[model samples]
Target: MTRQLRRPPETQDLSRESPTVSVVLLSYNRPDYLRQAVASIRAQSYRSIELIVVDNPSPSSAEIAETVAAQGNVRLIRSSVNSGYAGGMNRGIESAAGRYIYLTEDDIVLDKDCIRHLVEYAKERQSGGLVSPVMYNKTEGTIRCAGGEFALGAVYRRRTHGEGERDTGQFARPFNVTYIDGATMFARADLFRRLGGFREEYFMYVEAVEFCARALKAEQTLTVIPRARVYHFEPPADANASANF
Candidate 1:
């Protein structure tokens, strides 16, 4: 059910005076992971924040709704059909009422200061159109993506920086990047809305790549803030599934 749960007592007095960060968390069938992700967002150090959970017609929709209702302070958007990553996120983005929008997946567990650090960096780097935190594998304790770049050739290819590398202060500094991973993206609300959000035609994969490409074409900078961190609990690849490429 699409509904806005009552705000928690602590946030009842949240006013529009401060810049608000709207976190658009997309949930598929991973209800357990969604719970963890919501908890982490609730624990964020950034006080001016709103959590919008978009359920993309998961089989476990009832359970997902139950989990969100338990929070009693989040906005949940339930889609009738599974619209994939881009479409689901776009729904949440449309309902966002913040100055900044953060898009993340259910499998992500963010650090308490992740949003705070991202906002700080974005404020300092006003040119940044998209900013993201360094992501590490929750299980293996290795870098998943610090930032990423597109290696366009015969076909489009994505190269994630520091993927599978042990995090040992290598990507410790913030720097410019071609694109921020879709797992976690912090963007100015105006720019994201102006770009019409992600292209729904991509459905799931490569949507972030195309969106970043468009942003770059507009001369906007994309960056990765290393001080902010998130752990990605990526599911194992399907061995039986065929690779078309």
Candidate 2:
């Protein structure tokens, strides 16, 4: 009888060495928008990410959560009452269990490297409490937010850059910034908990700005990483996107 080749021992278990990152998104009644957002997230280059989607008591949101959950790496949370942006995000953030937590919108489409780039930038900076990227408007192909600065009077925290190509170089470099739109924000979980998350009183607008301001007051560094850009899918062309916000 021919000698049988020795077989290698079978491995019993396998585990990933990298830490997990949690992406928390808040959704209302926009099921279609949630689908697009989930699709983009499922295509991320990073494999160790947990997606947490919180529905703010929308009548049709259960279906949205089901559809998103089908894609894997997703957790759905539904509220009994319609909590606005701040309240919903608070719930999502509390459920996230990753070293880094990404606060984002259900209507945005992310680039493949968006999360990876943000994590890398945060690691390199070593002191960034919050990091956000340049956001582009899907409808007009224009720049939405790229490092805002506050000025005196009406120009305070104004977005000075022009639309489209005119705002190209504004985000070419990374530095400490005044405010980052909550539409896409990556923050260290530890730091986030320490800060107690967003001030829920704002309800909607200005909450993000207030968070950054508080972070600054506490001497926590907030940086804008230019390499990671995301598409902010605002209102369609048929509607007045400006008034919608």
Residue 66 of model 1, lDDT score: 99
- Which parts of model 2 are misplaced by more than 4 Å? 1-17, 151-167, 236-245
In model 1, where is the ten-residue run with the lowest total lDDT? 236-245
What TM-score fits each model?
0.88, 0.83
Q: lDDT values of the candidates? A: 0.80, 0.72
- Residue 180 Cα positional deviation in candidate 2, in Å, after optimal superposition: 0.5
Q: Which ten residues in a row have the lowest lDDT in candidate 2?
A: 1-10
Residues 1-245, model 2: lDDT tens digits = 11112211332112234457788888777777788888888898977888888888665667876777687768888887865777777787777777778988767889898988887777666644788877888777788777676532332355623335545575678877667787777887767766777776666666777777777777877677778878877654223222222
Candidate with maximal lDDT: 1
lDDT value for candidate 2?
0.72
